[model samples]
Target: MKRIDVTRNWQGSRLDRFVRAHIPGTPFGVIQILLRKGLIYLNGERASGAARVKGGDVVSIDIAESDEASPPPATKPKRGPGKRAVKLPAAGAAAAARKKLRPAAVIGRDIRVLHEDDDVLVLDKPAGVVVQPGNRAERGSLLDSLEEYRRRSARTRPRGGAAAADAAPETIEEPPFPYTPVHRLDRDTSGTLVVAKTRPAARALARAFARRAVHKIYLAVVEGVPAEEE
Candidate 1:
């Protein structure tokens, strides 16, 4: 096993990000696999890429000497008229284009539902899963599974309710939302995700997240104890 010590500049970055910056020739997918297989350890404990690191943390890994690769070159931003507007196809064209898209079935094994209510659904997104369809990927994503599940659930769930006969015009609203993501996570950052099942819920959840009303916490394992508390 080879060991590396984290420096002050690398503190607070994701352990995986730090590895990629320092270790060359190892792809992220490989690193994740190695982590799962007990080939990688942080401070003598098995660690996930999502682990956060601090200065003086020790990383132990199995890698070749020649794999001391350099960091990848930075990508240049695309030049366009401001930001290029994504032109969604027209209705008829949209239908035709969608016909060519992959079948809207869950390509991955399953959607791990953590919680579900009338307004929102919570899921545990696995590390390797994508939340939505990518430009080049043919596999369906978590979004596709949710869409399919919603479509089927609508057939069983009751949609009819007592209509308020005396509602004011100002209170009227648009239609209910389809399954929509409240926020996004990087493809490899496996964690809890909240999705809105209705428009009202979406707005409320978005506001809550944006305003930092929701309490957030992170767990990490450091290689060595800090000499002083900050």
Candidate 2:
């Protein structure tokens, strides 16, 4: 059996995602099956994959280290720095192949990145770019460029387990390119948009949008200008 302690970084995150984080390279379907079989528990009770976990909670998984289905590569976090590094699965040739197939509008495109942090990424999306993939769209999307940007960033940063132990133990490292668009602008509209780097941040931003707490302003370019009073 393996155990994990929930921290504030994981608060409000889906239980299934949390589990997947610990066990790298595990498929989502496998995680769901474990949850359904009651092999995974939260605070000693069987919990659904969608259950939200908060700080100070304990999660237990009833899988053997030596089992054929499970591997021993899972790193056990120690109480101090300089622990074993967590290995993120390498980006394979498939990713490169996909990038090659993307349109020029996406590949090597200059995205006007406004701001970025551990929680969110802000971008000034260009007018001709789509926010996400669609059946009818022919060109590339803002998200495709975002993924490429993330890949570049990942190359510069140290993997989570090593960095966390050496610098800030409390930091919960996000997966590479896990960013998701919280909201979107029309393809023809050019404006700033925010993308969530983590699930908790995504949920918070979603709530803010749902409650209309976020304010928006639009601008337009016209051929002629009218009187200020009119």
Candidate 3:
């Protein structure tokens, strides 16, 4: 611990500034270290670096012997003492790189809902939008839209985003409402679609599609051949 006498020379000066002026070779960061460690005191009480030093103020500092002998960190000599200015790379390159990471598309406003109930929602799939994210998917797909729609349509948010546990006495049940697509259409395909609003409903609809139980028909169909009564 080193104690420094505050004289008229340091009157009205900040503690950190006074320390730096009196101790020429010390780095400014060292004073911060002492202040943060509760090692700096003024008038026998802990003080911050920002405290003002008055005449006859006895400032005490806890510091190692090496601290006094240590040399100041070397600074790079300023380029011509003031003409130093670093050049930054062009903004276009950075913008292009950022663009690649952003979603390739935003959900369009044209999505039309055809049917909605407790367990399912049927929509008119707009063409040129993907049913799911792909290897190069940037803007996201139809699934992204459904997820966003569900969040917005929810009347209340459950605790921790989970369904409220208070609804059940024996066990806490997680909120189980999420919109999931039962099947996928091509990115550019437009048609009637079915979306499940609950996990059980999703599973049932998925199974129906998997087992070829659900029937789909496209009005004004194009680019397909009809079975010739085979």
Best model per TM-score: 2
What's each prediction's TM-score? 0.42, 0.44, 0.41
Error of 1 at 213 (Å): 0.8
RMSD after Cα superposition, model 2: 19.8
Error of 2 at 152 (Å): 1.9
Candidate 3 wrongly placed segments (more than 4 Å): 1-108, 135-137, 156-171, 175-177, 219-230
User: Total clashing residue pairs per candidate?
Assistant: 1, 0, 5
Candidate 1's residue-wise lDDT over 127-210, tens digit each?
777887776465577777777788778788865354644453446666646799888867877766778887657776786676
Per residue, candidate 3 scores C-alpha lDDT tens digits across 1-230 of 77889999778888988877766756666666667677778989988888999999988877774365444554554557535333212224333433553433223445666555567676667888887776655655777788787877774644543454545457666975768777878877887667788765776677556544454556665677877542
Give the worst 10-residue stretch by lDDT in candidate 3: 84-93
In angstroms, how far off is 50's CA in candidate 2? 41
lDDT of 2 at 25: 65
Pairs in steric clash, model 3: 103-138, 104-138, 104-139, 105-139, 163-175
Q: Which rank order by lDDT, best down to worst?
A: 2, 3, 1
Candidate 1 or 2, higher TM-score? 2
For model 1, the stretches where C-alpha displacement exceeds 4 angstroms are 1-108, 158-176, 220-230
